[model samples]
Target chain A: METLSSLAVPTVLILAGLVMARGKNAFDAFLRGGAEGMRTTFSLIPSLTALICALSMLRASGAAELLTELTSPVLSVLGIPPEVIPLAITRPVSGSASTAAFSALLEETGPDSLAALCAAILMGSSDTLIYVMGMYFSRTHVKKARRAVVIGAVGAVMCLFLSAALARIFFRDAA
Target chain B: MIGKCFFWICSVSMVCSVITGNTSKLASAVFDGCADSIELSLSLLGMMCLWCGVIEVFRDAGFVGALARRLSFILKRLFPDCADDSDIMGDIASSVAANMLGVSSAATPFALSAMEKLDKRNGCGDTASDDMVTLSLLGCSSVSLFPTTVVTLRYAAGSESPYAVLVPVLICSVICTSFAMLLSRLTAKNKPLGKEKRKSLGKRKERL
Candidate 1:
């Protein structure tokens, strides 16, 4: 896996080589592309700022924790292990919160346990659904993104159940 | 919808903070959040530009068009509206490839480019087309081939078989992506409250 990521540099060099072989100015193309990226980055900053502020306030005010605790009972009824509930709840809202919850889960459940396996898989399979929605939709002038959010949330929930089921099947002997 | 949700989140947090007597903490968080976002964007800008530049080189060399043509078999089904447009499909192809490879930094630039192209294609420029929703949906439910960060975390935590969850993660991601796509497609028929319709309705009311 590490080797695969390491290949990224070489892949870029190869593309650059291919461009140069065509007798065109790869550097000039690169500079223009970079300028385009700068524009995209600037456009994204406003929404990202608002989103991060709201989410951080949610966290700092302890509302996020309250919400998670409120949802845990319903989650438990769905067969989610109590140990992984916090991770699942925080997974879509904030990436850093979920990572913290994940490490906490490993600490509490032991890394080789079924709950830990489930948490790991859940983290791996899912992205920050709400954050992605905010970032992507910021690019367009769309005012209505409710349906997109609903669909993304559904996908996140699907990942949650699928992760638990797969973990239980593959790690039957795990503690 | 996003605006409403943002408003609700902020208001809810403020109310919760007052109730919990953590108003000071919430106040601090507001500034901290702004600072953090700028820091994040700064960190992201480097790799974002690099990947965009790299992809540009490929685009200049005509490699993107060839790759798009090759991937259109699958891309066509996912983005029927963009199937005939090599330019849009090419951007979408790069975005999807970067996502699958778990290079999210690389993916965002391409994804942004694709979103811009899709927005232009939609013509409305104000309302998000079905294709735009689907593209954003695709980014959210990432079907990564190698979830690098998760595996590394597991290994760091001393798991005996850090890679044991890889297959299951892959399976879960695939299932999630397909299900989301199906839902998006099903919901695609209904147009959102488009500006054109609203404008026409307002004119009709004014004449009345």
Candidate 2:
């Protein structure tokens, strides 16, 4: 119930500084955590960079746009609007990519669009299975990447359902 | 170092993204998108750094290890292949902690680490371990308390109905988690975690 998350890092730092004055162990703990935090974050660079780069290229080359154009008709049937298609397509590929798409959607269409809802559902419910599997599992020495796909597919379908159901019930902008 | 490398990579990629545009208008759209993207990256950087700090405090307090032990029960059910205590469990705790805050991107490495631990024990056997399957199936979904990306997207889009999504998302997360758990329970058994590991984990707990 009590999460340090509620406390800003500065406040936490001040508190920890008090705790530190009380005992060196607390300071040690904070330093250790910061070090580990930095290291773990650094490790993500490989996957994070690749994902951004790929998505960037996709966007730059109009691959995302073309893909959107192709999927637009199908997405239309799902009640997802045109502006939101990029987020939908990108969501499963990379969270950052989908986020970039969401930004564009928000910039172009406004956030209340039905498409934004769909994109959000996609992000909330889904995983970037391919990137995850490739990076995490590959290092873990897992040979097969197929299972991640299955799980990803399941997540995607569930997201699709949730989006549609919510759109039907809450999204009044059928126009 | 990695952060700097990736930051530049992202910047270049975004610029490349602009130039590669066959049409001119989309270049602006892509640039506009990057503004928010950069902000999100900063927030994630700040938030995740803070969590990492909290985790260190938890480590010093010995709370994370204890929490890991408690979670090991459920984890045991999911990853019979892994040791009782491990860095992976610690990672899972951090991952879950991050997930609670709507930092799924931050959680991926931990989830992968946890899965790797489970898979290590998966043993090149005929059937995949039940725990491995459950971990895969249960996975991570956005829970109720904090749904940052959802809120952000809505906010960015200028949603009059931004908060309107809270209930539906909360309910959907619960239902989907339950559904995945149920299905994992029914199917994973035939694959592995049958009568044996269940009894084994129970005995282990009794001893603990």
Candidate 3:
């Protein structure tokens, strides 16, 4: 995993070398790109602010816990570990909250425990679906997301179930 | 759609907080959330700029175009409606590549650029086009080869074999992404295209 991450930089360096070899001024192009990136970030702020605030409100009001309690029984019946239910629920909503839930689970269950492994797999396999949708759609004039939400929800639910099932299959003996 | 969801989320949180006598915490969360969003975006700025810069260089070097060509078969299948638009295809290619690398800061700019182009192609309509929905779905359920953040968190949490979950994550993500693609394609077919576009396509088919 570490080696994979280390490769990301070198890949960029090789790309830059190619750019220079092609006789383009790489540094000048980079500055132009940087400016464009700045504009993108600024445009995204309002949407990000709205989403983060709502998510945090959901987290703080104890609604998240209530929702988890309501869903726990069905989730358990589907073979999801009870301890990682919070992680599953938050995983698609917000990235930071899910990370916090993940670490909290690790601390509670111990890093080597079945629940921790399951949570790890769950967190690793999925992106923050709702957050990504919000950011991606914010720029568009599109009001109705149509079936996008349903599609994302389907994918996210599949990841959650697969994470639990795969963790058990791969790590049951180790646990 | 998103506005309604966001409105309800905030309102429900407020109502739940009041009923549970936790308004103070809720109030604090409101401020914290705003502050956190800014902080997060600012922190991401440097990386976003760096990667976008690299991507700009890639565009100039014609590498992004080459990538679009290389991935044409699958991308064409995924984006049937707008597959002929090389600009859209190029942005999608770069974004997907960044996503696979787990470099989201880089991915967002590229994906957003693609979204803008798709929006224009859709005539700046309020309703999302089929290709737009597919792009967002693909972005949401991207098949990331490296679950870098999760591995680091596990390692910090004292897991003996932090990378042990790599294969499982890979399997799960690949399956989920495939499912997402299939669902989007199926839904796109069922939704029915706009009248003019459909007729045009039919006419083109007849001509062919």
Candidate 4:
């Protein structure tokens, strides 16, 4: 599965090339499309810069850690492990940051631990919603993504709660 | 609105850092963040260009159209306005498929292309349309049948069963995606009415 997933992009490229053979102006079309993609990428620079900067500053300022500490009490009341609070907070904003936090959790509490398992489940089940929203909205030049952002946040919260609950159910014995 | 929120949060964080005597750390973070964002965008550029080129080939060869036709039934229900726009539909289908396979890097380009096409179809408005919101929802809560990243991380961490979280992850993803869909549907009807209504009312009063 790992090999196949890694090869998926190359496979699609090959197939696309084969399909392009039937067309007379494949090269021109490809270049045209590539140019369009570049344009989109360039347009995304401002929004991406703002968002990534904000997120990074939020992380580096220790605000994220403080927020996690503040939320841990509320989260524990809902049966969530205090350990996974950082992962929950970071997962939606930055992918690499959350992955690092997840790795730290696994190291702190063995991989077999309930906290590690919950972290794994939460990471897999949800996505970096803010990042995705920023990219998509910027690419499309959509200024008002208020609704999409709200909905994505709600979905992320659902994923967090459900993952924690399911982890408790499934890893009860392991913990 | 989202941009403003980010700005305020960022400002607040900077203020807190300064007050807490973390000025040096904050300065480094700003520089590092700028550099990181540039690197990230460049990497995204490479992937987007590659996939866009390939997809263009598919489009020229009619494969995209064929794929769109194949998935039209479901796509129609999900994005009714895009029923005739096979290019957009094809991009959406490919994006969702790649996401399901856990090839998220590949999915990004497709999703962006689909959003671009959807925006064009919606007359390039500044605000996102309902279809755009739905697509964003799907992208954010993408249901991955094979979460290779998590499994690999678990293996590296020396788990007895790296794939043990598979079932729970899948179930959780389904629930999350469903909730996203439901929320999108419920909110679709409640378009921001404040500015539009005030403007229209002012026009009506002036005419009267």
The root-mean-square deviation over C-alpha atoms between each candidate and the true structure, in angstroms, is 10.1, 7.4, 6.9, 10.1
Q: For every candidate, give the share of true A-B contacts it also has.
A: 0.72, 0.27, 0.77, 0.73
Between which residue pairs do clashes occur in model 1? none
lDDT of candidate 3 over B128-173, digit per residue (tens): 9889999999888887765755766666667777777877888888
lDDT of 2 by residue, B1-208 (tens): 3344345534655565566644554455445444544554554555455555655564565543465456556654544445466676667665655554443555567777777676666664434455555555545443434455556456545666555665556666666666655556565544335677678879989999
Best by TM-score: 3
Q: What is the alpha-carbon lDDT for the whole of candidate 3?
A: 0.78
Instruction: Give the runs in model 4 whose Cα sits over 4 Å from its true position.
Output: A1-70, B1-72, B190-208
Q: Could you give candidate 4's per-residue lDDT for residues B1-208 as a string of tens digits?
A: 4456466758978987876666678767777767766765565576567656766666566654455456567656666556557788778987876677554656789999999888887789888998899999899888877665576567666788777787788889988887887777667753433567457657968999
TM-score of 3: 0.67
Chain A vs. true chain A, TM-score per candidate? Answer: 0.59, 0.56, 0.61, 0.60
**DockQ for each of the predicted structures, in order?**
0.41, 0.27, 0.46, 0.40
| DockQ of prediction 1 | 0.41
DockQ-derived CAPRI band for the predicted complex in model 3: acceptable
TM-score of chain B of each: 0.60, 0.54, 0.63, 0.58
Docking class of 1: acceptable
Mark the regions of model 1 whose C-alpha exceeds 4 Å error after superposition.
Answer: A1-74, B1-70, B190-208
